[model samples]
Structures are given as C-alpha cells and as structure tokens.
Target: MEIYETQEENAWIFRIDGRLDSNTAPELETTVFRAIENGARRMVIDFEALAYISSAGLRVILKTAKDLKRLDGKLVLCAMQDYVREVFEISGFDTFLPIAPTAGDALRQVAPPKE
Candidate 1:
C-alpha cells in the first residue's frame, strides 16, 4: 500500500491506497509508530483509496489505537468501502473503533477543541 501523510491543524491524516495486508501493514505500522513517537496525538485515517485489508492490517490498526489510547490520544477511520466495513464489523472492531462515512466526518471526530 501507498500511504500519504499530512499534518493538519487538528490531527495527523493518513490517506492509504492499495491493499493493506501482511506485506504493507508493517510499513503502515512503522509510519504510525514514528508519528506517535514524535508526539502526534490525534490521527485520522482515510481509506477511500484502499482496496482491501487483511487481518494483519486490522492488527496494526488495533495496536495503533491501543497505543494512542494509552497516550490519551484519539484515532478516527473513514471512507471505508462496504466490503471493508463488513470486514471490520465481522472482526468486531466496529464495537470499539470510531468510523465515519467521510474523511470530513472523521476529521471532525478528532478535531482539536477550539480555544
């Protein structure tokens, strides 16, 4: 998978393209870990271009969420296709992970509070 990351005013946004499987999950994990180590607290993942996700991908996402929670941070996932959403639902991830229908909605979910 190809990941394009950007620092927004409120959160770190990652737009993923292609499949997120065993081969690509490691890369995503590394990128996310590096960002968190650098003090990123809020994150939004856009899956609009992502074609497929394997259990390995789910593991990476779960780990990232757990790490962020330990740091008192937040994560939002959005733009998932129907099949992807089904996968999350089947995995019971929908119970805990925050999912939005659009990236804008995801961003709002993780947006920094106004001063």
Candidate 2:
C-alpha cells in the first residue's frame, strides 16, 4: 500500500492506496507513529483508494486512536469504499471510530477550533 501525507491547516491527512494487509500494516503503523512523534494531533486517514484491509490494519487504527485519545488528539477516517466500510462495521470499530463520507468531512471533524 502507498501512504500519502498532506497537511491541512492543523490536521494531517494520510491517504491510503491499495491493500492494507499484514505486510503493509507495519509501514502504515510506522508512518503514523512518526507523525505522532512529530506532534501531529489532528489526523485524518483517507481510504478512498484503498482496495482492502486486513485485521492488522484494524489493529493499527485502533492503536492510533487509543494513543490519540491519551494525548487528547483526534483521528478521523474517511472515503471508505463499501467493502472497507463493511469490514469496519463487522469489526465493531464503526461504533467508536468516526467515519466520514469524504476527506473534507473528516478534516472538518478533526479541525482545530476557531479562536
């Protein structure tokens, strides 16, 4: 899988392309962890181009979310295809994790508050 990072105001957007299985999950985990280390608090993971996701991918996401919570940060997921959305639903992640219909929506969900 290919992960693309973009900065939108105070939020960081990570777009995932292709399949996220055991092999690619580590890469994603590392990338996200590095971002967190770099002080990325508001994040959005875009799954528009993602074709598939395995359990490993789910674990990475859950871990990221938990870490973000501890830091008082936020993570939003967006642009998921039907199959990908189904996986999240079946995994029961959809209940706690926020899923938006588009990247813009996700960004808005995690956007910094106005001063």
- Model 1: CA > 4 A from native: 113-115
Residues 36-80, candidate 2: write the lDDT tens digits. 999999999999999999899999999999999899999999999
Q: Candidate 1 at residue 22, lDDT?
A: 97
Give all TM-scores, in the order shown: 0.96, 0.97
- RMSD of candidate 1 to the truth, in angstroms, is 1.0
User: Which pairs clash (backbone N, Cα, C closer than 3 Å) in model 1?
Assistant: none
Badly placed stretches (over 4 Å) of model 2 are none
The 10-residue segment with the lowest total lDDT in model 1: 106-115
